[model samples]
Target: MVWRQHRIIRLNIVVLLYLMVCFVLCPVSAMTVSSPAEVHSVRGNAVTLTCTFTSTSRATSRMSVDWSYRPQTGGPPQAFFHFSSLAFPPQDGQFNGRVKWLGSPARGEASIQLLNASLSDNGTYTCSVRNPPDVHGSPTSQTVLTVTPKVPTVRFSDVAVLLAFILLPSAIITLALLGRMCCPPRDKSQTQGYHSPIEVTPGDEPGFKQINRKEKNMTCCDLYFLVWPFFFFCS
Candidate 1:
């Protein structure tokens, strides 16, 4: 009897372990929220909310998807959406006649589109999914909808515009100044009439006369010729 009881206890332990293993091996359904969770919507424009999910079994048309909203300060989630009987409710108050389901539920898509979004719709939103007996959990995602007032954009103050109009021209002027400083202008005065010594001939012009060095009362032209050799050597 003692051996039989021990065997029974061992069998129970094995059964418990097998159950635990089955539970551990069960796959968890996954849902994904795309980036840029928060989106800005213009008063007259539309915006779309995107999400993705994966599961071992194919999603059917009967699957339930619920989109809800909770204020930024936090509170009970508000039921803004429900999909079970292929029915959709009219947009409430500020969002009336402006919200749409962008996804084809038969294809497992759960995206929402908001048209003509208004300021009053600004708040946090959550998306949840239910896949029947296998999965029924709220894997939530949050988004802040903001309605902005239309304002004219002043491109003059934009950084790219400033760089093109102001900074670029300033840089070009600076470069020109640097170039001028590095390369000084040539001296036109010094090179006005430089004649080669070989090209110069005595009495080339019809002067009055060439006087000998022994003559007195020497003129400025005489002094110039006398010092020409010295000037050439100094240069």
Candidate 2:
């Protein structure tokens, strides 16, 4: 009987050891971070960070997920979210009135949306899951949240109107100046073959014809008037 009892005890120890090994090798049922390892948002805009997790256990609804922030410089983590009794606390200072839970917790959803984001929201965010003594302490998964300032854009219509108002007159003036410089007007008398008459010497009169002063004056005046149109056009 003594030998039998000893064998039974040894068998029980071996079985217990086997059970311990199995438990050690089994994976933990917990949430995991799956999306948005790095996220970006612009000031005055909305942003959503996503996290997906799965568990083999059936007590997922009873689990709690926590979201917190830790500076890259290292310090105590700041709490941004917590789930318990189906309630979440008011948003922290800069985030107040701008943060919201995306959906219900029972579905393993832990996404959060931030509204009217600002520069102060930049930090490292950590998501953790807890299910009490049945599981080990919640493991932390981190993401970097970066806030970028929005760039101002000019509308097409506004740009077109501005160009018309500011550049149109300047362009016209430039073209007029260029035209005047490139093609200058010639004197009318020279262009029309009208020249002042020269007086002939008494001895040389046989070779050249003499012109009357009145006729010469009249011809010069006519040529001047004829060239007036070209001068006016250039001006």
Candidate 3:
């Protein structure tokens, strides 16, 4: 009978422990943090590093957020931003006057914005959220940030070169085609002038014979020279 009573007491203790865990400890095990895996931004623009958290309890002023950055050159990470009841951005450093808190704990947002991003801002960033009684799961999340340099502006000289190489040739071809269509070439057969026969002597030069102009096959240039003298004398 004594052994039976001892077993009953052990069973009661186990039931009480299970009740305490279900009511008090389960909520703390539900806290979790999350962030984006990567973010891309251009230089001279604003970029946001978004972070969020899930908690079974309501947020309070005692909760805190911490943001840290690690340079690409490989070194220890540095804390650049912090928040509790108020924001605490770096006062004098790479992130001075450039980082702002745009988060609302009631809405589960813990995002931070960086203005006028530069190439030096490319690195890894970490966000940590800590709330009492709900810190069982991981409270830190990391993101890789890549800041691309701004593209160079086009210059007048480049535009001129492009026009010379591409636009000029295309314009010339178009104009040539328009000219051919508007002013068709004159027919060479219509311009063929009649030539009179010429008197010629053979090797002895004693006899004279008339040679046909068609047999001579005179070119246009020869006919022009022949007619130019006659025109000059008549004028």
| Top candidate (lDDT) | 3
Off by over 4 Å in 1: 1-21, 27-35, 71-76, 133-138, 152-235
lDDT of 2 by residue, 1-235 (tens): 9999999999999999999998899745454445568998898899986765554454455777778877756788888777764648555566567768774555656677878888877888877765543364334677898999999999999978876776666555655665565445645554344334466444354322332322344343355456556544643
| Cα-based TM-score, every candidate | 0.49, 0.58, 0.58
Q: Please say which candidate is ahead in lDDT: 1 or 3.
A: 3
Angstrom error of the Cα, residue 15, model 2: value is 13
lDDT of residue 150 for candidate 1: 61
The global C-alpha lDDT for each of the candidates, from Candidate 1 onward, is 0.63, 0.66, 0.81
lDDT of 1 by residue, 131-216 (tens): 55436334555677777876667675596787777766765565466546544464566435455657666545222132222234
Q: What TM-score does candidate 1 get on C-alpha atoms?
A: 0.49
Q: For model 3, how does the per-residue alpha-carbon lDDT over 1-235 read when each residue is reduced to its tens digit?
A: 9999999999999999999988885554557889999999999999999999988778999889999999988799999999998998899899999998998998888999999999999999999998887867889999999999888999999988987888667655655665565445545553343333454233322221122333255544455555456434532
Candidate 2 positional error at 46, Å: 1.7
Candidate 3 weakest ten by summed lDDT: 204-213
Model 2 Cα RMSD, Å?
A: 10.5
